[model samples]
Target: MAINSLKRLALLGSVAIGLALPARAQDSGPLLDLLVKKGIVNDQEAEDIRAALVKDFAANTSAGKLNLSPALTEFALSGDMRLREQFETQRTIAVPGTASVANERERVRLRFRLNGDLKLQSGWGAGFSLQTAQNADSANQTLDNIGTNYGIYLARAYVSYQPSLNWFFTGGKFKNPFFTTDLVWDADINPQGFAETHTTFLNGKDTFEVRAGQLVMKDNAEAIAAGAAPTTGVDAWLFDQQLVYTKWFGAENLSDVLFAPGFMFYNASTITSQVSGTNKEQAYNGSTKYLKIVTLPGEVNFANIYGTGTQLKTYWDFTYNTAANDRAHQSVANGGYGLPATTNKGAMSWLVGLGYGYGQGKNKGDYSLKADYRQTGISALDPNITDSDFAFNRLNQKGYKFSGSYNLTDFASLTVTYFITSRLNDSINTKAPALAADPTLSDLNSTNTLQVDLNVKF
Candidate 1:
């Protein structure tokens, strides 16, 4: 028998057993013996086939290798780990009804995440990620003397379909679809919903995209107890739509520039204080309800700036709360939880940021520096969804943030970040009375946070 034909037959047999070539060849010794006995092929030819299978396996097992099948066109795995030490401090205005006048906190936190991706033949794909954390806003687990075991959760699990090169749809818990800063949606928030994006290539150097998504923020089961429809209570939800445009300017010497501008409209369903429990709960959970928020986000980036293998980026984000009055109405209708009724008006918030060097470090000595300034009005943005690490996640606070990072190796890095909110809305009559006891925000004047992290990825 021809050696090539015998090799093909052996490969088929191995695939039937779901084993790769080299391992399959070794396990096929009995079949080869039978073939030799039947005079189908001599022992020498069988040995040669086995040797060729080994060579093929050796050639295939390289970096980025995948064990592919008819149904599984591609597969990949990746993950990261981080260790952090954080310190936070805040001072209050010392009103009579408050419980505490000052706050200080310190913690050591760690985070790890692992992800898997799969691509099918019919333009469909799925992804799953496991992350350490019990909270949606953070993947960090704090180390404590109690020897508390960390928790791992399903941070992301989504299925995607790409009907064409220009359109894509995804469902399940996935990354946020809107182009935004952490001002509204924290980087850690993976919204659970259906999301879609369509891209149009305007020209060789320009592109436009439309992104939309609807997220279910909360599902109240109060109806079950009240003997009503399942959707009786306000099913907290968010609707988002955005248009993004991008243009690439030809390189200027060693630097290439790109400018992107985007507009987003975010809407929330009924946010009633009746169901939102205490003052803290109302502030954090019900803040997004009954509001129309519009955002304009713009960015300019220069790659290889100064020819030092660096990139410079600047961003400006402007947000207007069209329903701030509505939120204020809800607040006043609820008796302002104890305060006066003078806080009823829509508000705005703006942020400007500058970044230097590679955004995410890649190699040893690689570094990044970033600074951002944020000014927020009382009713500006959704407080519940903002970055928790920023000023203890307070709204109506003005602050500056500074961050720097340096890579220790290709997959490991050290980073330091500091945030200072010098001004805050702490007037007793301006806030609900229930919040008067919470030292973290109520009666707050200013707060500061410092964090150091050692990050590793693969």
Candidate 2:
């Protein structure tokens, strides 16, 4: 009986409240009055009017809907693509060069890149980039090959771990720590070896960076021969190391140019010469005091060029970067020659280079111009087939490039460039007459190559 009485009292109270409330609230009357009485909608109505949203919320609340979770955010993706073309011209007289000059050939290449950023609930985040080149990685040549197929160039692939400020480590292919232009390395199209970088600070608004790694080398036997030289090419091991340092030059972006120079140390096996077994090379056979009248006359040091030889090859190079507007060209001049630091009877050579650009000045003209040059260090050139001894000499190289660009539009442009080089004087070949006597064939040396190419990137 008490329970029934309580239920009736509750029903009567609900009925009394319903009767007292305005009937217009249940009808299609002004919704502002209900909000105004509940201290919501203001009189001037400056607040935004979300009609559908308020109606849905009201219906759900009336239906006894209790919200527990928050709404999900959206994931977005972005990418870009580009096309490129290249052409070359080679017109030269007969020269016994390493290979035939590649003729006038035209090719088109394609490139694409994609990026994804996953924003987690925590402040920490992760992302990756998938890139591709026109020359697909193939095991063999094919017909109708446009370029490398569209595949994961994997320019960078890594899971970032960031638990502090200005600190991160991504374990995978990444931008080389070396400071240089993309066109020189086209770092975007190909992935290099492993790399790492660390940044520390000085006073406020100041920081420093350090990077280092190794690259694949040792594909040249010239290096192996160098090491054996008191006798030849500096012998090098299979790989090369890289190191660089960068520091904040000044304060804001206007003064933010970085100064970075790098160095490397190689780990190579020493080379030595062996004089036993089949190597009866008569060249320096214990400095023959009594010359034999027979075949020994033609024997030279390299008669046993096959001997086991061991030696050390080492060098040091330093490069510097300055502000764009700063006058620094002369300091970066090319074509250098010098003797080895070590007294081991061998030689080491080095050179550095820089260039200037004008078409990219403040003028919004339709065309641009740039000039640049680079050089190789001094080294020995193979001349006489019978000269088994290594001679230290200056045989440096040089190259120059001229370029112009025409603006097609905001996102497109036409570029044309001419690259050329002057012939360098190698060691004087005294043995040419002896070898040229053969009426069947002859060998000659000359240097000249020209090229033209087109590039498009975004």
Candidate 3:
């Protein structure tokens, strides 16, 4: 009997090791259980054998040999990919001796992103991501260049700490921390700076939160000449703050309202054209220092509408640039676009939207439909950071956007979006022409865009 038990133990050890290489330690449970049931080993002995098997397996597996830092309690990886078909058409109004012209374009684009997160003890974490595009406002890469390999960029790298349940802090280039819409800020922009957030619950269900950020827009160094003193330029910065409130309604808390009001202040010098014999240089458009904006964005959501698993959502966004200066662009001599003062009334923008859906586009058979109308003033928001698909990212525009999305599977979805837009002020030319003879200065007559996308998430 003693000899038989020893042989049984040896066989079990071999089986455990073999299974552990490609499987987890739990995979050896059945063999251990059978040995104990047949009286080849007692429960205590079986337990001891199981522990030994696990230890041996750990020492032999790649994960166990990784020598990961003890500070890292958990790690996770996730990402998504998107394929798109895009169509765009733009009409340029006729100038004095020119005829109106329409330009149409079609293209295929792709985007991919990968993200990694590491969690450590003491409420501290770090994250990083890689994406396919270099543009701050876009992640899509045109499938051109004769099939050349795409470039990948570091999209996000940040460290976060949550000292307590109600407070959080983050530093480095990270995702937008404000509750906002594309009407004022592009969705793809990751601001490089520091953010602080604090939240407090009211009535155990409702909550109020405060978020603030100090972000760097541009860094300027002094210019030195052979015989002249160093001439320094002011660095541009964006200071932002927002107040958010969420309130739940209905007995089951299936309905809710969210309101976030925000303020943005830009601190920088105005851009001016370089003189014929000077070393000074500036952007084509005037300075961002004129942008002091206030925004109000809110939404109301009703879930399980009439008990049918359908939802209804209504949302709106409004912004006003308090520091918009018409004289900034009143004349070409002042580094302006040479537009008449009356045509530069671009200090306000707004949008209203409605949406209905059977599901949140999560599972198969779930679908959603949405429509929105927006009007953007020339100086209401930063034209460089607006939605690229709308009016070709131009300001002084009004338009309607329609979209539909359906989930093909839990991890994949198909979506279609259309935009119909035209210039809000016909007198304000969309292009900032350097010379009066520049034909591109024609007013933007119309713009239409269509996009179809296949997106997969993991």
Residue 282, candidate 3: C-alpha displacement in angstroms: 7.9
lDDT of 3 by residue, 232-344 (tens): 56666788999999999963325899999999887764333312112112343336677789999999998886556688889999999887664235312244345575655
As for candidate 1, its clashing pairs are none
Task: After the best TM-score superposition of candidate 1, give how far the Cα of residue 184 lies from its true spot, in angstroms.
Answer: 1.3
TM-scores of the candidates are: 0.79, 0.44, 0.83
Clashes of 3: 0
- Per-residue lDDT of 381 in model 2: 14
Report, for all candidates in order, the number of backbone clashes. Answer: 0, 23, 0
Candidate 1 per-residue lDDT, tens place, 169-255, comes to 999999887788888778998888888999998878677888888776666444464465555355676777888888777554323
Question: TM-score of model 2 relative to the true fold?
Answer: 0.44
In model 1, state the lDDT of residue 40. Answer: 73
Question: Which pairs, if any, clash in model 3?
Answer: none
Model 2, 1-458: lDDT tens digits are 12244543453344334545322223322444454466644433312222323443456544325342232132235554554454444322232443434345454544566766544433344456666633212111122355744445444544434444445444444444455431112233223344445667666656565554443212224433444655322332212123223333332222233444443333332222311211111122111111111100000011112222211111122222112111111111111111123311111222232322223322333455555443322221101111110110112333455566655554455666555543232321112322332110011122333223233334
Model 1, 179: alpha-carbon shift in Å?
1.3
Tell me which of candidates 2 and 3 scores higher on TM-score.
3
